[model samples]
Target chain A: MYAFNYHRPASLAEAARLLASNPEAKLLAGGQTYIPTLKQRLARPSDVIDIGGLAELKGITEEAGGVTIGAAVRHAEVAGSALVRRLIPALASLAEGIGDPQVRNRGTLGGSIANNDPAADYPAAVVGLGATVRTSKGRAIAGDAFFTGMFETALEPDEIVTAVHFPKPEKAAYAKFPNPASRYAIVGVFLAKTASGIRVAVTGAAPCVFRATALEQALAASWSAASIDSVTIDPSNLNSDIHAQADYRAHLVKVMAKRALAAAG
Target chain B: MRISMTVNGRAVSGEVEPRTLLVEFLRNQLGLTGTHVGCDTSQCGCCVVHVDGVSAKSCTMLAVQADGCSVTTIEGLAQGGKLHPLQQAFHEHHGLQCGFCTPGMIMSAADLLQRNPDPTEHEVREWLEGNLCRCTGYHNIVKAILAAAQTMRGMAKAAE
Candidate 1:
């Protein structure tokens, strides 16, 4: 990792000040992705602000018929939390199915969504459940508007994500075809029946997590796995690499969506 | 940066670069060579250790990040000069060949058993996903973990 000054700010205000003063300072949440990037010399920030220990940014709270999870809450904590399991077992399952025990232990929800890796599992959940991303600036961006593109979000440079509020879904499930080696989703799908509507979010299939509108519509008409069986997925915009072809990814998207729906049921 | 942490049971403090990994700090600075670094990319769980009594990849974490946190490495597993139950079980079950991944596998398995005592074989296998053992095919390792869980349970019952 590159040599950079590390600052452990006790408060979000201090962290924001550090980021504002030092234009190149990066907030270190879990260091799961950022550390690796630094080690590879991919990024060279002037300062690294550590928010891992900030008490204000670490917790899960059930309120207003939804669960609000702090940004610094680790994946392992979410996976192990009885509250998360009781409120949203599918979210707990999704957290459990992330990278491995060790990775889950250290990877934070804030870091995961902020990095916005195209293949990440959390994006599917965030978009599928229509979660609200709350930033330090007291802005609440809807899940649909938060994710802009691959490795991109609506967050400004210094703006920090404080918490994510996920409404209680009638039923929700996430299914992923993970790469054997990395355990990242080759094509993951998250299905949820919410008060707003039935939502289907597909991850690791394109530049960013996207809603499968056709599948969502089909499921809305009839909440069944077979409902979207004939709904064709377009391969034109899907990702194609050595792991899988565009057409293959499109096919996996459909399969995973169906699986997610069945699992949700 | 000067950071202090409880390793094993002793509080140790040292000056280290901000970018230094916890594994590097543990092995190089603290001379705790039991935590090995097989894959620096965090894929291999060779550097698995307990941070604040929970299993974490030391290689993926910065030494500075471990400030004021208690860490436990494989070297700390044995108590009173006796092998930990997991270690003994591994030996009895012939869980290793090259011994390269033993330390990490033992640590990860220990954490798993702590969380879920008397875990099923499937649970043990799933828990070992992060810890890779190319030599053993994980057959003996799984057996060792199960055996250790049984022994630990028996010991706990006797103590109770």
Candidate 2:
């Protein structure tokens, strides 16, 4: 990796100040994604602000309302936490099933969400669960508005995700078609309940994670896997990578949704 | 860059380049070769280590990020001429062959057992997915962890 300045600010305010001072600075969360990009020379920045040790960005809290997961919490924590299992077992299972044990132990929720990898599993859960992403800039972004495209997000350069709020869902499940090697989702589906109603989100299909309105309408009327039998998602907007073609992803959207629905039961 | 960390109960310090990865710092500067680096990307687990008791891919972390944290490597598993239960079971079970993936497997396994002591075989396989072993097909590796869990339980019973 090319040489760069490293800073570990003690507080979020300090971290934000550092970013404001140097507009080209990048926050180092778990480094599972960014470090690789750096080593590959995919991205070069003036400085890296390490946030792995930021205490405010760590923890799993379950209160009367919902679960507020610290943005920097590792995937392993979500998969193994007692609170996550009891509150949202499917969410825990989804985390547990993410890229091998090492990745889960090292990759952070904020990092994965911020990078908005099209094949990542967390985006499905975030959108389907109708979560709120709270940033260091004191701005809250809904999951629908957070993601824009592959390797892209609505996050500003100066904004840092401090925490993500997952409102408790009545019935939620996530199913993914993992790459045989990389374990990234070829297509993943997250089905969940929200105050507005039910939401079905798809990832690894299009340039960004998106909602499946067709499936959601069916499920809202009848919360069963069979309810989505007639629904057919269009593939025009889906992405085609080495893992699968657009047609395959279009097909996976329904199959995985049914599986997730069955699993949710 | 100059940084200090409590490595396996010992205070270690080093001066390194700004882009020095934690794994490179440990192996090149500190001479803790037990923490191997398998892949440049964070995909491989051969560089896994404990940063403040949680398993993290050292290759992905910058050395300076670990300035004030605690780290535990494969070398730390054995103490006072004794081996960790996992190490003993691995030796007895032939959990390793080429040994290239041993350190990372050990680090990842320790973290897994810490979180779930009585993990199922499927869970073990799932957890070990990040740490790739091109040898032994991971049969003995899983066996060693199961045996270590039993040995740990026996030791706990004896202590009681």
Candidate 3:
């Protein structure tokens, strides 16, 4: 890991100030991904601001008929939170299935979405549930617009995510075919019946999490697993790697969508 | 940066580079080699330790981040010169062959028993997903953890 200056700010404003001052500064949330990236020398930053200790970004609250989770809250905390379990059991279960026990203990929702790994699970939940991400700059970015591409997000260089607001869905479930070693999704699908309409989000199959409009339309019409039987996913836009071929991921997407729909029931 | 923390019920302080991992600090600075580094890629749980009573991969955590937090390593498990119940169970069950992953397995199991005292066999196996036993002695490891859970439950009842 490259030697860098570490800063632990007392407030979000201070952290933002440090970021604005140091153009190459990176925010360290959970360090689950950042630390590994550093160890691999994938990134060299002039400064690292630790936000894990920020009191302002550390709570789970019920607000406006949904749940607002602090950006720094760990995956294990979300998986174990009674509030999350009661309000959005699907999200809790999604959190539970992320990585493994130790990774879940330190990985944060904000960090996971910010890193925006193509195989990450949170992006599916964010986009499927139509959640809102609040930033330190006081911007609420829709989940659909938050992720730009693999390892990319809509966040500005100095913008820090403060919280994520997941509105209560009528029903939601996530299913994934995980890689046995990394536990990352080879092809994952999140199905949600929201106030707006039926939504289907697929991850680990593309450069970014995307809505399966065909599956959404079919589920909206019939709300049954069989409704998506005729809907075919194109393999051209999907990711193909050693874990699975693009065509195989395309097939798993439909299978997982069906599984998620069944689980939502 | 100078960081201070409680390790094994003793206060310790050290000056570490910003890039210093907690595992490195424990092993190099403090000379606590009980926590081994297997993969160093965060895939293996060889560096499992309790920070503030919750298990985390020390190799993935920065030493500076552990400041003001209480850390419990595998070396801290014994009390009054007696092995922890999990340790005793592992010894009796021959849970290890090379003993390379034993510390991490024991620490991970300790955290599991703290949360779920009476874990089923499946739960024990699932909870140990992060831990890797290269010797392929997972059957005996699971057995030991289950047996230790029972013994710990009995000890709790005896105290009651």
Of 1 and 2, the candidate ahead on DockQ is 1
Per-residue C-alpha lDDT of model 1 across residues B1-108, encoded as one tens digit per residue: 999999999999999999999999999999999999998888889999999999998989999999999999999999999999999999999999999999999999
CAPRI band for model 1: high
Put down candidate 1 lDDT per residue, A1-265, tens digits, no spaces.
Answer: 6799999998999988898899999999988888889989999999999998889899999977889999999999999999899888889999999998988988999999999999999999999999999998999999999999989999999999999999999999999999988889999999999999999998999999999999989988888767888799999999999999999999998899888877987
TM-score of 1: 0.99
Regions of candidate 2 where Cα sits further than 4 Å from its true position? none
How high is the DockQ of candidate 1?
0.86
Candidate 2 DockQ, CA atoms:
0.76
Worst 10 residues of 1 chain A by lDDT: A221-230
Candidate 2: global Cα-lDDT? 0.88
lDDT of 2 by residue, B1-160 (tens): 7799999899999888768999999999888999988877787789999998988889988888888899999999898989999999899999999999999988888988887878888888877887888888999999999888888878878999
> lDDT, candidate 2, residue B10?
94
TM-score of 3: 0.99
Per-residue error for A217 in candidate 2, Å, reads 1.6
Order of models, best DockQ first: 3, 1, 2
The number of the candidate with the highest DockQ is 3
